[model samples]
Target: MDQAVCCYRHPDRETGIRCTRCDKPICPECMVNASVGFHCRDCVNQRGGTHVQPRTIAGGSVTSDPFLITKILIGLNVLVFVLELALGDRIVDDFGLYAKCVDLQTLQPARCGVSDGEWYRVLTSAFIHERPSPVHIGFNMLSLWWIGAPLEQRLGRSRYIALYFVSALGASAAVLVIAPGALTIGASGAIFGLFGATAVYMRRMRYDMRPVIALLVLNIIFSFTWANVSWQGHLGGLLTGTVLAIGMLYAPRERRNLVQWGTCAAVLLVTLAVSAIAVSQVTS
Candidate 1:
């Protein structure tokens, strides 16, 4: 076997230094010693040509910015939990702190607080949780992180964020129809959407579905076991995620943008319509 070439900057030179860039064998002439290893001129030029490096995880798949958006969401959840904790006994009686939507009497949008005009609670309630317990927030945030990060990395920031919010709204829309008087909070709906997305993504990508399918089953089982969990929200999120993922990943490649958007819009409208009918009877 030929001996490994030395990586020093000399043509005839031989030593056991490795090239940091490209990992090609570099006899001394080509070696430019850097902190990690000797690099060749071509490697340096290539690195320079690509001004911005793509971020990658250890296995080399591209990853999104880990700290900025994902961590910001986590931080907000934690901060809200802390604030809820600090309020102590006052938190229990205050309706303003928690998110509520819909008037019990009119079945229309109403203030979450005692007033009758705060319709924003329909969206705002997503950010809040029912209990102030650290464990509740911890579990929800952890679930979001676990499911959200991989998705953001794969789908890019904006699309992934849209997936989250839309799926959540779908879940809330379902909950509004199914259980209006029940105060629902936490990121579970969004988390369920991720599961739905993951399943569709894996199927579209031709990845193994065993792991993802198992997770879906376990979560559904857990929802049944746990008293406070919203089965409606979870089910709604899962269906929404499946439908959205189909639109995003498997919609006809030949279709124009407007056509695709219109298809998704029509599906979403039907979903909301069904949810509204469900909520009307249940919340009443």
Candidate 2:
């Protein structure tokens, strides 16, 4: 009589199942289903590692679907909008980015702008919109959905998110430097960043750049022509996103990872330095 084969993982458990790749005996608990047959945990993990795609600049797994991050951003923006509507104009007053030099005490309604240490407006302002105008939130969210998906795919989740906040900060910094006393709200800066990044990537890949360039030109013109638009915010975001894209898409192959990350870090640091200077100028 032939002796029974025991599982490699659990010597006490005997089974007919064997790893598809290694042909080793395995118990049910150790088995991972494969296209042809079951593979053992070791074999399955090894195969997965072998088939793993290269990491992005930010060391995140590359995915074909960009919808996850894009949807999250959209959802957050919408959620904030709903809260703003529910809570009234108070939410906008507290969250909207304003010039540090603006004296909140002088405002008619009282506490309409940031107080002396409420610096979080730089980030919070991006999620809020002008309460009276649904069009502000509508257009920004529409642009976000339109441009964010492809950019997320190209940059990967981590890098895409990083680029977004960097662009936002750039916008806020511009507001602080150029028009610190004016109240600004909306994600237009980040949306413009997506547009800029997409254009840069497309240009680097030798794709036709006319469409993106035209869109950017039209938007800039609109910013100048439109009553409430912040041309400074748009310009700042576009410039920042373009610089980051150049680094991400055109780095040398031999040291691509290092160069990509280094470029992003450098841009972030410069933006921070600029913001710090602007804040100091405002406070002084």
Candidate 3:
């Protein structure tokens, strides 16, 4: 009588099955179903194995709906605009970005501004726009869809959201430094950040730069030329986004996530520091 072949894993247990990939005798417990045949744990856990999940360019998870985050952002901006219109100027007064502002009508004390401990205005102000100008929100939303959608798709949701938030805060900080006490509203700054990032990403991929360059130039000119526009916000957001995109896109593959997210944290901290200093200048 011939002796039975023992499983490589369980030497005591006799088995007829073998790992299709490595051709080693395996027990039933060690078998993993594959398209062609069974695979062992070692084969499945290898670098090019089925267990490995796909990753985005910036080390984000490859999502089924790449544009979901961009859509959500647009929805939030629209919702805030509607609330501003329905609830009156109180929304603007409370959320609008300013180093120092007062109730122009009442003239008693400005309920809004960074000086009075309303630091949240740094980010909230990006969502509110001029109530009388329907064009304000309209232009911003269109630009957002154009620039934000593709950027969000490439960078993925978490990285994209971080960029938007930090850019908005950076815009408020610049407003504090450049035009302190000036009331700034609209999503122009955040949208400008998207423009800057898109331009950088195009350059990284060696795409034609003429279109984004032209658009950025035209917008920059308009920001300075147009009355009631916050040029300071635009400038700040552009600088921040450009720097962040470089960090996210060029990170080393081995430590990509750590480097990319760390860059975001560093930029955010610097913006907060600048904002704090600006606030101190006003208060002191």
The lDDT values for all models are: 0.62, 0.76, 0.81
Query: Which candidate should be chosen as best, given lDDT against the real structure?
Result: 3
Write out the backbone clash pairs for model 2.
99-180
Candidate 3 stretches with Cα past 4 Å from truth are 1-51, 103-112
List, residue by residue over 1-284, the lDDT tens digit for candidate 1. 54435444464544443467677655433444354444666776776643333321111123335435667778876776666677763443342212344655998755443123343444455566755556777788888888877766655455566667777777777776666666766678877988898788767645557899998999999987898888878887888777776676565434533443564576567765665565445434
lDDT string, candidate 2, 1-284, tens digits: 44767889899865565777899987545655454555677875776544434343223455657568888988998899899889997787778886543345774333333435667888898899876568888888889988997678656787788889888888887877788777888899878888889888766544557898899899999999999899988888888888888887677656767987898899888877787777677666
Clashes of 1: 8
lDDT of 2 at 260: 76
Could you tell me which 10 consecutive residues in candidate 3 have the lowest summed lDDT? 47-56
How do the candidates rank by TM-score, highest first?
A: 3, 2, 1
Model 2 C-alpha lDDT versus the unseen true structure: 0.76
lDDT of 3 by residue, 36-87 (tens): 4456667777736667443445666657887888888889989998898799
Top of the candidates by TM-score = 3
Write down the RMSD of candidate 1 (Cα, Å): 11.0
lDDT of 1: 0.62
Clashing pairs in 3: 102-110
Compared with the true structure, the alpha-carbon lDDT of candidate 3 equals 0.81
